[model samples]
Target: MSESARTHTRQRDDASGATTPAVPGTASFDRLGLPDGILRVLREQGVTVPFPIQAAALPHALAGRDVLGRGRTGSGKTLAFGLGMLARTAGRRAQPKEPLTLVLVPTRELAQQVGEALTPYAEALRLRLATVVGGVSVGRQAAVLRDGAEVVVATPGRLHDLVERRSCRLGRVRIVVLDEADQMCDMGFLPQVTEILDQVRPDGQRMLFSATLDHDVDQLVRDYLRDPAVHSVDPSSGAVSAVDHHVLVVHGPDRYAVTTEIAARDGRVVLFLDTKHGVDQLTRHLRAAGVAAAALHSGKSQPQRTRTLAQFKEGQVTALVATNVAARGLHVDDLDLVVNVDPATDPKDYLHRAGRTARAGRSGTVVTLVLSGQRRETSQVLADAGVTPKVAKVRSGEAELTRITGAKAPSGNPLDGGPVAPRPKNHNAPFRGLGSTKAAQGGSAGRPSRRTTEARKLAEAQRAARVRRGG
Candidate 1:
């Protein structure tokens, strides 16, 4: 059968044609016109059944129609678009700077991950895929386009840069997929997304998938999608129902200690902090406690972010300290624990952060640290998200914290109820652009604030001490 006919048949048979099913296995990939070579690669990768998002959206996506898929993290949206890319781009004619398909994501990590997910399927069709995101040389990406890439997975900013430089063009692009649309909106990339979409061929197929259909997401659908099919899956709580939720009320001082215990787990631990500085400090503390860890935020270069994720995925780093940038598009399977170092302000964020672990029907724990002052906000989040967390006073360095979070034992609390390690004042380190010329001028503009200077000095001192110890 033709791809569009097959997809139409599958959609007609689906009870979730209009509404997304809250469960998986409603529609098989084969029914969605997934080519044999793609199926073979999927089998080799051990991805047999489709997730709910995939089951609901694949048919429409494969049928050459715009689709808006609403599903949470770990709901298998990546494969949904991957299948679409493979089906649409296979046997298509294309040239350098003219890709048949494009996938835009919020972060570099997600760009790489989406690229990885689509690579095998594309390869099965004798197609090449290129990943273009920030933190890497634009010349390299321009060269990749010059060399010819069938599909491109990229972040909006980097892709925009390439377009502005006339290194690539999407005039002939047949398909465009935006993964984690809400997160892209949350990161203030909606304008960029719109710009990129505008540059694409107006008649091209488009699919936008996200966890919640917020105002920002709604805007994209109205602006970019044409007669789009909307499919939402089991939206009772969040995208992931497999996660167990917990809210621990701890003293402000003990928060760091509690965070460290959770970070020192045997399996993969994703800890979400509120700020870049906090993540950097937490990463240092966790590493000093002998836990293999890395940090993901805008502070790190694109290459650094990529390497950190690779290490975490390969088990070289068991714990990953991050901000919200890693909360949405990051798909690390079998993550044992997710610690919300800071309370979530929005109901959607609560759901997305907790969804990091407990993916693919696997049991995982979601522990949110609630300071006394944050009780009100925390309670509001749980109520809005329809989750009742186990609330109790827990010490960071205690076994109860580990038991609640499913984290393993640590030899000792690295902080010992002491001060959290400070970030360093290195000329090489990146700053958050705090309206201060000191950062821009490197040490010449002026001295940083007392608090800032102290933190920087502490970081430098720690590094010096580490060097002295031959670490």
Candidate 2:
């Protein structure tokens, strides 16, 4: 960002607000019609101010008006709708197997993240919150629902499954939230989403919030939301001003070398690839080359995915190589870089990947390591995304690569599958079993290279991931 542009950009903690074009003055939670308890909680959390989207939509939402909110990821969309639900449903009680408020997200990761984000306030308001998602113990989730939860955060598929089993009911659901609606559509969950929405109380309040508002998402707005007060804090754009975008064109042979260098950069970074197979492949290579890298994709068990993210946030893992699962809902304070080892297949994917950084008013960089073969198509995708990135033709061990990404040579001692050298910070990152990048190169217990065995296991588990698209 230039000096002139820097003056116009405002950053908000993604846990609070997202980076956005500057708006005049700041907005406070107390002035946004939040209940006294929520306001007190916000202040206690040091969040006296609300993000632009939150400031704009909370009034209508609290007034029982349907809301159609539009904002990029991390722009405080969670709290914008969350506070209203928590406030409006404050004094309500839910019967066994029936929830009063429902939040439907696209993926299991997102569902879990939202539930975690809202848990504190829900507790403050005496609401029991249940997170329903796939890949976990459905029996436990059913038990929670059977015991009754005032709020349920879920993915469309699992929630639908629960409904089919008669373990849960939607009749009592008075407030419905379709968060990341566009993603639900993109992931082909529209049919299931609409089915679930149909089962909810007909005249209940509805809110649809997303980064983009086209395609199947529009269908949802037309069919479900009634007379919504639409608020768009940031227009859908590929080139967000807060992030410095770059495309480093590299030779095919040096692609991995360049990527390894960037992952070995001084700070923590999220590296994106399009496929689970590719993510695992690169993760193995990075670990073998001595960088503390971890793989996050549908290939791993849900527990593995959860543990890996916790480690990454706590700095036990320096490099996270993932598919779109980590693209949204994953938040790390002060993460200044996101790398596209493989360019996104579309414009929306690009924006979501870029959103991982430049958060909370902090300036971040998104770097794409492009091969010669992919340059043209990648250019078209970026153009569609409205990003005119700084294009650089570079190689490994070069000054320009170092300048752009702070790339450095790997230690080459191979991580040996043990934990990375910890870089713990002040934040309260969760404690987990903490394991990623496999054991030392030699086989343990008849398993050839532990990293190799893990990689094979991942590849085997994900052989059909590209086709099935598991949550």
Candidate 3:
């Protein structure tokens, strides 16, 4: 397809996704200029309206101009670039072991997500899409590519591994997209990205999308992009407006119970914990509670990660308990809730975690479980991040929780029938000061010495102190 024709295809859809028909002076998809076939596909998929990112990047991305997009995760990035990739590669014939379009992402989960998002649109035009990542066997990906997939979405490490092993080639790649470029830098994947980019055709189209473009990302753009068009739809300054954030403070003993209650009645919940062990433990507990949950962490094997993600997306698992693994690259639709079991140490981490919800302007909730000790630290983080959440104590089985979550309480007490333990008065006794040691010696050990000395004094002065004074 011609570049001009491709650009027009993505820009044609500007309608809001609402079901209500457009009135006079109302925004419509016709304003953006998408093709009727693509529009039909979107409508069938219940995507009638355009998200801000999609509206902002579609036009330039489709035009085959190297576009730099600045938007948060779940801000319709996949569709934005997916439309661009589909529009550009529509008429191109698939070649064996060579892809016409390539999408580079940070993590395996994201690669699969992007592939899934674009698959339906690619299928409309009979374009093939293959996922290449490290966890699964590369042989399967090689076979799929050999069968002639037009597009390839892959993680940087896995994709580079494939290239080094001579399992894949990028000489025919026409469109190259680096989604979540900032995240790649954070994960130390720049070398892999640089290696992968060196192999792709230099004269081909390149589009880079990220939440924020820092020095490292700028370096990639300067070296890779050719007079790239920049589009900043919600830059760092603009990220907060798109997300709704809240912090819920609870007692230390009631943390897990509170988290379980919040996650139980969610739409799609990406529950983030501080550590991998937490992820595994939370997954087990949630599953036992009849709330289907899948654990995603670095400890899992590749196939396990892939399967867990599949179940999560398919709604077989209502909650996905994860560490930082799902923080950066994941883009899920209609994520109704984001429960941070442990509040993020910094505001940046908080923003990344909160970004999972409130994506695509669909309006979602972000509830963070802050135990007693975490209140001050988490409060500082949120304040620095410029987020203000309604602070309230969560009563485990109270009416407020019921109002917030429509689901009823589980049969028995969710706290494992343990009584709340009061904090010890001498909390610092284990590391007590010298005064405490001296007092202990004087009170017990010193008493015996004083009594023995006083016994001899009493015998010597038997009747010497018999006088009494009257006032």
Highest lDDT: which candidate? 2
When 1 and 2 are scored with TM-score, the better candidate is 2
Model 1, span 329-376: residue lDDT tens: 677867868888777888888888887787766778888888787888
> What tens digits encode model 2's per-residue C-alpha lDDT throughout 373-420?
788999998888878899999977889999999998887766766644
Those runs of model 1 whose alpha carbons end farther than 4 Å from true positions after fitting are 1-26, 396-399, 407-409, 412-471
Reference-based TM-score of each model: 0.81, 0.83, 0.76
Q: Which parts of model 2 are misplaced by more than 4 Å?
A: 1-26, 417-471
Candidate 3 lDDT score at position 404: 50
Assess the local accuracy of residue 209 in candidate 1 as a C-alpha lDDT between 0 and 100: 79
Could you tell me which 10 consecutive residues in candidate 3 have the lowest summed lDDT? 4-13
Question: What's the ranking of the predictions by lDDT, best on top?
Answer: 2, 1, 3
Residue 408 of model 3, lDDT score: 40
Clashing pairs in 2: 11-361, 12-360, 12-361, 13-360, 417-438
**Steric clashes per prediction:** 1, 5, 9
TM-score: which is higher, 2 or 3?
A: 2
Q: Candidate 3 residues 1-471, lDDT tens each?
A: 223111111211113422322111113445656666677788898886666667667766767777677666666778877887788888788778788999999888788878887888888877888998887878887888888889999998888877777768898898999998988988899988888888888888888888766776977887888755555555464465555566776655455555666556746688888788778777666665656778899889988987887788789878899888888766667776777877788676787777777666666667777766678888898887768877777755557655654334433323333443222222222211111333464445334577788997996676555543221
